[model samples]
Target: MDARERLAELVQEKGGSLAGLSRMLGRNPSYLQQYITKHSPRKLEEDDRRKLASYFGVAEAELGAPKEKSYDANQEWVDVPRLAVDASAGPGAANSAESPFDSFRFSRKWLREQGLEPGQLSAIRVVGDSMEPLLREGDDLLVDKSDRPFRDGIFVVRLDENLLVKRLTSQGGGRFSLLSQNLSYPPIAVSAEDIELVGRVVWKSGRL
Candidate 1:
């Protein structure tokens, strides 16, 4: 069935009213009902359309009436590389693999230029401010697994095998430290062996 018809069924199954769906999508309740029941689609901006799709657990193109020529599967293909999330890599880590993502292509290119290589490099969505002013939350990070660690450079490391993005600095002795760009957060220190250097960060690009 078409998106509107499917949405009507999904809303009923989920015990969600048009008002509820409107709230979930941050849309006006009345407008949403008209769009869904009457198939009179509204001219929502792209971001709003994306948010609506995410709220409905559907694709952005499916937010309104089903468009003609909408079922071109080849046009929608994504080239995903296998990426391991270290946190979820225990016991059946192999089973919980996520589809490959293309967020880190440039970072992968930079790694290759530096002679550190991996089968593939993927961009990871940043979620914390541990890297602070330098790297904000939601910034995409390029991690190069084939590159070795350096004394003073930003790197994506798995501490005790848990993934983290921080700066590696020499602590004077046999110890190395993870430094945070934000002054409020303290640094982390550990032995070289305990830290697994997945890759050094070559470049970061994002607006505040």
Candidate 2:
């Protein structure tokens, strides 16, 4: 795709508004909107393009800047988007906007070791104590968006409009229970068709 398309995708992926991003760039709130929709400036200014590339953690050329003949051969880290899922370990509305709030870098080797691809991964925060001890509140979790098969493990799922993070135990048939690590929280029996599996929780990190 072209620069405008790529920019639009990034903005949408982050669940952000053009006005907000324009403000961040110290431009008028309508700057991006007009630029994208109306083609006011025709092409992104160098400074604006640079800021946008930095903000999105992408190469400048991806947005609209001229590409170079060579890239850094020593680059070892790749960024994984941290989405604002605010997913609670218990039953809660995943109704909040799903967008990239920030990014964290991991070594390419480390990601490969975990069988994770940066394009298929996102990070989310635990919001409740339902899965305490094992998954504490305030923990940052790395979600593998590609692991959607039924498995007996923790997963981030969407039921109707609600988003949830819990463990799934297959029940022979196409059924499973949303299990909580903490016994205080009872299990929720659900059919596979009722819930939209978001992805599986693959890695977690947080304070002790």
Candidate 3:
């Protein structure tokens, strides 16, 4: 059976309605039902397909993921969890609720070349337009959780009860100025103890 048929079968087996599954995918309640019955939009977006495959514990290829890439038998690959939380550039993502909704596969050699350890990494998406021109909405960022030294760079930080992605500069005396690339937003000064560092954004897995 094809992807649509397979998805329909899975939804049936899970004993849930298409509307419920659509909600789980954060889409309109009729999203899946229309996709299955009407086939509008022609195909599922890659992110949505990947998320469904993970949630259902199935291979992405089974959901029509471009027949999968061929990997060398000896080359090592790593799976980095893509947390389902936005690192907002504007107003922060409140409470920073997050969980691994999918994963990104990268060759082990590539990670080593970048001096990034696989175990100390996670992926998240960008939101809002504060860091525009450099980082845009929907860009996927590879975060280095182990590289937590005070430094000048784009980073994910927790301020108050919200999570944000901003450039940080040391203000000395245990203080920092959160800088935005867009410059339309003003800088925020906070003590080093007040800002919780989530990770440094090492690379963006989006268009150049």
The CA-based lDDT of model 1 is what? Answer: 0.54
TM-score of 2: 0.70
**What would the per-residue lDDT of candidate 3 be over residues 1-208, giving only the tens digit for each residue?**
8889999887676454777557656788789888888997588888778667654545666666775532222347667778888888997877434556677988878888998766567799999899998899999999987744566999999898788999989988998999888889899999988988989999897766
Which run of 10 residues does model 3 get worst, by summed lDDT? 66-75
lDDT by candidate, in order shown: 0.54, 0.77, 0.78
Tell me which residue pairs clash in candidate 2: 14-100, 94-163
> Best to worst by TM-score, what's the order?
2, 3, 1
Residue 112 alpha-carbon offset, candidate 2, angstroms: 1.3
Q: Please provide, for model 1 over 1-208, each residue's C-alpha lDDT reduced to its tens digit, 9 standing for 90 to 100.
A: 6656666665665444777455434456675678766765645555545444433335545645245523222232322122334221111112223333232322434444666433323455555666667787666665544444365888777765367777788787678987777777777778888877766775555676
TM-score of each: 0.47, 0.70, 0.63
Itemize residue pairs with steric clashes in candidate 3: none
The TM-score of predicted model 1 comes to 0.47
Looking at model 2, which ten-residue stretch has the lowest summed lDDT?
66-75
The runs of at least 3 residues in candidate 1 whose Cα sits more than 4 Å from the true structure, single-residue gaps closed, are: 1-99, 103-120
